[model samples]
Target: MKKYIVVALLCLTGLVQAQEALFSGQQVSSPQVNDDKTVTFRLSAPQADTVQVTGDFLPSVKVDTPMGKVDGPGKALLTKNEEGVWSFTTSVLAPELYSYAFIVDGFKTTDPANPFLIRDVASVTNIFIVSGKQADLYRVQDVPHGTVASRWYDAKTLGFDRKISIYTPPGYESSTAEYPVLYLLHGAGGDEEAWLSLGRTAQIMDNLIAQGKAEPMIVVMPNGNVGQDAAPGAGSDGYYTPQFMTPETMNGKYEAQFKDIISFVESNYRIKADKAHRAIAGLSMGGYHSLHISRYYPNTFDYVGLFSAAIMAREDKSGAGVYDNFEETLETQKDNGYQLYWIAIGKTDFLYEANEEYRAMLDKMDMPYEYTESEGGHIWRNWRVYLSEFVPLLFED
Candidate 1:
């Protein structure tokens, strides 16, 4: 009994020591949002030769890559203090959600002090929001929030069970009325969770509905990659690295199987299952899907949105599937269109010229569409703005 008592005392003493060490005053607090609207990032790298911080909030620099010249996040060197701490303070930054990373001795890494993080493609970085007019809708405000559910449905067309993310509006649970559905799609290297996590879909929808800016509607987000069941680590092929371009992407496979998603959504949810109450929109590769899917079904979706879309015809014009017979299908879609067709792209986006050509084609065909041109290139910032603008215009009487 005495031996057991001694062992227990030793274990308790070790635990208390660990607690004290964890709670010690040596903790580093990073990404301090100052009152002056400037932000400070700190790292306690005592033996590091050099330290630097790079983020989207800073001015971008043009960097040349194998793909081409592109705008990259700017890096700021951190000054070392007498205590071996390295830190950097930025100037007054615009109100927005920003992501950043630290470079310690040329090694890119996340901030250990910052618990909040988001992954885009394969890169993971810490994120922070600067509260202001533009960023307010992105934050979770004191409003009636909606319910987001991860659902599994059998994709009979693809011969597999797929995962989807659904967002029902604030009053969907108690309300007996059927609601319109907006099918939201993500860009390349993104999954169904892209809009929920990175695009701030819930916050935007909740705030918009609470303020009476948008009508209550259901949102369906499904994985566009036909070869994958879900995002990395979330699928049966567990723990694989996510790539920018996955298999079966933009090969007309996903577009052909899209009806499976709609069929599932309509069958399971209390949705107004008609062309008038349905809408589809996406960014980048998703934009390509939206464009093709809306046209392939002709009289299906009344509203179609393409944000920073890849607008080009495929090499095979043999009228095989969604990619083939593009002009003919688009013309048919235009003739059968019931409501709005929205197209938006950034001025600096690589797809700008292609969008201009598509718009010209539309002009030739006398197809009507609302166009919005933003300042930045292909990015989440512009996509979020496009989504916020497009939702308000949807399901309007």
Candidate 2:
């Protein structure tokens, strides 16, 4: 027994010693930079076919950071002595956080050097913000600017507690004034925090508002996910419904779950409740929601935005003809006096065809709307570009 105890103790000590840190300290994290606005990143897999570093600062470049441009005795070659280890210095970025990732073959991965990351569903995305972009309204600038708050409440209809977040503009408290409200929604699998963390919304909102690019509207973001991992069919309700089917209906749940959000905001903040001051928008699944809500409850909102929305008619692959029930809803939205119904998505997204098809359908339906498309795939870059383009058009009257 004494001999066995000594062996176990030795084993435990070895195990503890084997634990190596991915990161060093509280400040040492990915998405962050060293004091000199530069960083040396390393990955210990020499056997891997090829490795390339890509990030927010560098879009889709097939090379390591610096690539000998920043500091290399050679041209982008990571020199290793005897032990198989690779090291390279990334480019110098402006003072702020920047997101980056190392790509091995076809797979995208985060940098081992930094700790800050944004989870892209199950996969993680390297994300960081470059501070002081035209004095971003929401970033930490000496004194903390306003923040986005994520809170949960019981949604009786869904029988489950749901969540929502609000982006309070800078000086939201100092001024005693009522503000317009923009209800933002995220795509499926996303939660209320997606907009703040992924979209950098608080900063975008603050910057836009400060720059007079966007009106001073209180932006409200809500989770549009189905309550269950699967909804009714593939979902959890013991019913067999299609994917993206929340009990809230196909994007139709907008009026139901989000109605609570409106009531809460109105009750809590100095906000304008009339149609002229209210707005709603989303991306992908959210875009579909925005479409449904804007069409179904035309009287509630004046500004309607669809970012990479799933707004087109569902294609019946069986060639059974006729997909989605849109006629009545179209008439209803037209009957209501809403002003803008803007639609935008990446040119290369799977939903792109649907958007074009939907636009053709809209032409036949005579449903007036705003539509635009730019370069890029179905990702945050397009969404961010969309926001920069779309927000300026809101509340124009």
Candidate 3:
């Protein structure tokens, strides 16, 4: 007992020392936003021989004339000053959220000074938002904020308890209103937390609702990984890394399991619970899931959105029988009379050709859909923009 007590005391003392060491320094301003809209990034790695900063702020180049632009991994070298600080200033960046990292002595790491960070699958990086004019839509304004909850529900189809992230509009608790629901999905390697943290879904919805651009609604973000019940470390089943390359993770399990999510939402929330009031949208793999789910479950969702969707012409068993009886399914969906079918992708996105092919197919079938072509490649920036645009058009009649 005495030995155990001494060991605990020593561990406590070491922890205190470590905490002090973390903050013992002259505070340096990092990721400093300048009046000119340029950003200054700084790091105090005195021992590092070389330091470089890389981020989304760097413009992507057009590799092929027709293929669109692609962002290559690039970095800007920072200059070390006499104060043992390495720093770099970026050119004036457009208003948007950007993720960045530092490459010091051949190792990449997040900025030590920045507390705001986002975890994307296996990696984590620091993030900053540039705000003004049109970009303000992605920014958090002084509007009435919505409430976001991380909750779990039983997925009888999957035979396990699953987790989801939900956003209820402001006044939802007090008001006796039956609201509309938007089922938002994350891309490959993402889970329920993706939209809440990286996509800024709450802020976008709140801003739009405050401006009367979008109706007050309940947003549902569900984990798309079938093998995993929730985001990594959030479930008792243990942390399962999303296997994007394998059929086990990409299989139609989630598509078949989607109904469970809807049932849970309808039962728990005061929602309209009708085809016209229900909407579905997603990005990347989530977009693919949305396409399949809306296709198979015709007449269930009146509005559907696909952002940088991973579309293919061939049928695959992994995707819940996607492209199986494709014509018949679409015809049935069209006949069911959806309010809106929207597809948006970046001009430089690698999926640009696939989107064009899908558009051609839609044209061949005489089905109607609103197509939006924006600037940028397959990225979260475009996904956020697409959501803001798509939400305002929902349930508009």
Best lDDT among the predictions, by candidate number: 1
CA error at residue 48 for candidate 3, angstroms: 1.1
Q: What's the lDDT of the predicted structure labeled candidate 2?
A: 0.64
lDDT for each residue of candidate 2 in 1-397, tens digit (9 for 90 to 100): 9999999999998777665332222222333346666655566655666666655554332223211111111123333434445556667765444455676665766666556677544446565554444324335444435667766655555567666778877788889988888888777656576677767687777667766788877888876763543222322356542333334334333444556667778888899779989988888778887777666565788888989887654433222222335677677777786778888876656677878988898899888888898765556756766776778888885
Among all candidates shown, the one with the greatest TM-score? 1
Cα lDDT, all candidates: 0.89, 0.64, 0.86
Ranking by lDDT: 1, 3, 2
Whole-model lDDT, candidate 3?
Answer: 0.86
TM-score of predicted model 1?
0.93
Runs of candidate 3 with Cα error greater than 4 angstroms are: 1-21, 24-26, 61-73, 239-247, 313-323
**Per-residue lDDT of candidate 1, residues 12-122 (tens digit):** 999999997565424877899998889999998888999999988888777774335656789999999998879899999888889999999999999988989999989
Candidate 3 deviation (Cα RMSD) = 4.5
TM-score of each: 0.93, 0.72, 0.90
The superposed Cα distance between candidate 1 and the true structure at residue 296, in angstroms, equals 0.7
What 10-residue stretch in candidate 3 is worst by lDDT? 64-73
Q: Write the per-residue lDDT of candidate 3 for residues 78-110, one digit (tens) a residue.
A: 999998888999999889888889999999998
Q: Model 3 TM-score? A: 0.90
